[model samples]
Target: MFTLFRKEINGYLSSLVAYITIGVFLLVMGLFLWVFPESSILDYGYATMEGLFNTAPYIFMFMIPALTMRTLSEEQKDGTFELLATRPLTDWQIVWGKYFACLLIVLLALLPTLIYYYAVYKLGATEGNIDTGAVIGSYIGLFLLGGAFVAIGLFASSVTKNQIIAFAIGVFLCFFTFIGFDSLSQLLSFRTIDSFIASLGINEHYQSVSRGVLDTRDLVYFLSFIGAFLVVTKTVLGGRKW
Candidate 1:
């Protein structure tokens, strides 16, 4: 598993895909967080990084799929997937190895954005007017959200050999998982059912976490979501053997 993990990471770094993925994520985020006149800090009239936290998940919904689309899909297309399955590593190991690689790249893309946080911190009228705990919680929420997206993308890739199809499916699944439930909850009239429906989606938990309320249930939700997708991905791969 470790070997597979390293190989996957090395493969990403050895190609332009890693740089391109990171570049795109940072560029899109940077544009909203700093460059764009309207959303930029200069016009926001505040020293908070809320724009980034609010906007990044939307960008990542598409960006993550692009990163993971080729993980298994390209291998299956090139007939390498069959050869890989014959290795000592189990299906879950392989799925996790690729999942971490994609997640790592996305996280690295997020690293540079810390400068924005620093800029916000310093740009504050009082040199520290920002809600430090909220910002920290939001960052943690974003990371978990990214992880969930990566797992979903990997599942999409596992189901198809066509990268474009994988990306489309992944994006659809990610977007639906992120917002579909929330929308459904709004349309329903029952208060209990409404909250339950909303809780099933990513946005509610993300919002909860982003508010600095570190609820264990939210963490469990993310972990369970990731685990469920990975298990499904492994099942998808297993089916190819039969």
Candidate 2:
């Protein structure tokens, strides 16, 4: 597992993918928090915390796909995938190895945001009276949200050898999963079913957890989503030799 993990990590770092992913994430966050006139830029009396949380999901929508686009696609495209498959590694090991490499990049991108938190801390009227709990909660939600996106992206990459196609499918699928159910809920004629549909979306659970209220159901939903997608990715890769 460590060997597979190191290989994937090296693959990402040796190429432009890791740098681009981190650069885009920071650029988007900086623009929203410091440049956009309507929100963080004008100091409209709203906390940066809100701006950060609100803009993060959309930034992640693009960044995660970029990070995962070449994970499996490049391997298959270059014919190195079969070599790895025939090695001693199991499907699960490869899946998790790649997953952790992407996850590490995501986490590294997130680490710089601590500066924002510190900036907010010093900028507060009082000495750190800001709602740190909610900020921490939102960060947790973002991590889980990114994890699920990575899983979906891994699955998408496994389905095709074209990196561009993998990226397109991964982005659309992530966006759909994030808001599709909520949109469906709005269009439903029956009120009871509408609420159920809304509840099924990632946004609903994400919002709940972001508020510093860690509901078990929301946690379960994220875990289940990640697990389900990872399993599917494993299955897809497993059938490569068949």
Candidate 3:
């Protein structure tokens, strides 16, 4: 598992994928937090990073897809997936290895945002009375959200040898998981069922956990979502060998 993890990390870092994903994340965050007019951090009038958090999901939508699109698709395209399957590694190990590689890139991209935190801390009127709890919760929520998306993206990549198709499928799946439920709930016939439908979405749980309250249900939901998709991806890959 460790060997596979290291190989995936090295493969991503050695290529332009890691660099481009991180670069795009940083660039978009910078533009929204510093340069954008209506929603700029400076215009928000608060020392908190509400603006950053609000813009991060959209940035993540693109960045996570890019990070995950090529993981399995490239291996399949190069005919190395069969070689990987024949190795001593289990399917779970390969999935996790690739997952960790993408997660590492996401975490690395997030590290630079701490500078924004420090800046906001210094800019606070009372020597930084910022809501550290909320920020930490937001970070946790973001990580879980990324994990779930990466799982979905990996599943999509596992289904195809073409990275572009994988990317498209990933984007659609991610978008649906993120916002589709909420949209559908609005159109539901029964008001009583609306809440249940909306709660099925990633955004609903994400919003709940991002408010500095770590609900066990939300955490479980994300973990289960990721685990389900990963299990499906493993099953799909296993089918190839049979």
TM-score of every model versus the real structure: 0.97, 0.96, 0.97
Selected candidate, larger lDDT, 1 vs 3: 1
> Tens digits of per-residue lDDT for model 1 on 28-119?
88899888886787788878888899999999999999999999999999998878888898988898889888889988988888888888
| Per-candidate count of clashing residue pairs (backbone under 3 Å) | 0, 0, 0
Residues 122-182, candidate 3: write the lDDT tens digits.
8877778799999999999988998899899899999998999998999999999999999
Model 1, CA-based lDDT: 0.92
Better of 2 and 3 by TM-score: 3
Residue pairs in clash, model 3: none
Tens digit of lDDT per residue, candidate 2, span 71-113?
9998999999888888999999999999999999999999998
lDDT of 3 at 105: 87
Q: What is the lDDT of residue 27 in candidate 3?
A: 85
The C-alpha lDDT values of all candidates are 0.92, 0.89, 0.88
Candidate 2, number of clashes: 0
Root-mean-square deviation of Cα positions for candidate 2 versus the true structure, in angstroms: 1.3
